[model samples]
Target: MPRVEFGMKTESGEEFTINGELTDDELLTITNFVQSAEKLLECRLVQCGNFLPKKITWNQVSGFDICEVNEIDFEALFACLHLSRPFILQKEPWSYNSVSGILGRVFSHHSEVKRELKGLRKIYSDGALSYYFDISIQEKSIFDESRFLSWLNSYQYHRDQDKSVLYDELKSSFSENGAHHIMLIRLHGKLQAIEQLTHLCKVIIKSSAKQS
Candidate 1:
């Protein structure tokens, strides 16, 4: 059997590598683990170079690496694999006036968003990391400086009004034709950039599925 190599991190932060054939049983185990809410919090993929596509490193001083995924094709594939509605994960609190955690449950089952969640295991386990999607997070999110405060104020205002119906609509535009979501994650007490948020969204989707 042909062998494939991959890496992963556990809840204890220890790392290990696996070298074996990509069998169906392994694939099913990985997918099920990633989609489990309990496991989604800490497990992560590591040493994923073998699963991603090949890239040439620039020898010159001005060289850089490139890995890109087409949004249209990715969304199409995502919809094809999914049978549920997409949601938004708000990092900041919605309103101090209402009961805590209620809004979060109303919006997403989990209030926190993480990059190296279990759902991402598939990217490395199935070779989608290199060919289908990128698994990196922006060091500095643009939302940290721009658009976050404004969005936060709007969210607070809607929530303060005690209009759960209006707040839900403001949270996610549930249009049938809508393709994807632009999520805002507030890390270090602020919203980070919008880039690569798709990865977090994917993790949340998988984790949430486990709940339902």
Candidate 2:
């Protein structure tokens, strides 16, 4: 293997220089970046968290969990997807809601998060979040068991004394906010891979300089 010097200059007049071969410290930085990225990539909210070593079936396919979802949480989840397509989540233009714009689907000034997105269903005609973000419910989801029970508690669904009574309090307190859509999954527990990985790439860039 050969080693050489690397160098570059940004349009902002910032310049960077490095060696073609990774130093011991640089190797550790790259290892951290790669491992962190791999962990984030493996962080999937599945229909089943644990599974047997046998082939699994698709029966568990159900709608989508835990901490109150926030703005950065969405960003972390979105970055993990490495979306090949553009997905600018916004209030439907047809929606007469007083508010408008990207991420407006999640937050609201005039009302609660749920109310801001009330009556949003994913039917063919309905331009719900599903209309724009059409991933499989099994592969990814925006609903959870708590909401399911809430729906069951509603007269519209069912409220069996054995099943619905116990969770009634939880149901009442569980805000119908759509935060559970992506759940509260922080990538590698708040590891910012884009910035760190971009840094590692800089450290690992092959040098064009010839060895002396």
Candidate of highest lDDT: 2
lDDT of 1: 0.28
Kindly report which residue stretches of model 2 are placed more than 4 angstroms away from their true locations once superposed.
1-5, 11-26, 42-202, 205-212
The Cα local distance difference test for each model comes to: 0.28, 0.32
Q: Could you give candidate 2's per-residue lDDT for residues 18-90 as a string of tens digits?
A: 3434344443433444444454435442212221112211223432222333334334444443320111112
Candidate 1, 1-212: lDDT as tens digits? 22334444667887765333323443333333224322222212111112222342333664323223112333332232121111112342221111122222333422222233223322212222233332222342222222223333334323333433322342333221110121111221111111122333333334434433
Q: In candidate 2, which residue pairs clash?
A: 64-143, 142-181
Q: Each candidate's TM vs. the true structure?
A: 0.19, 0.24
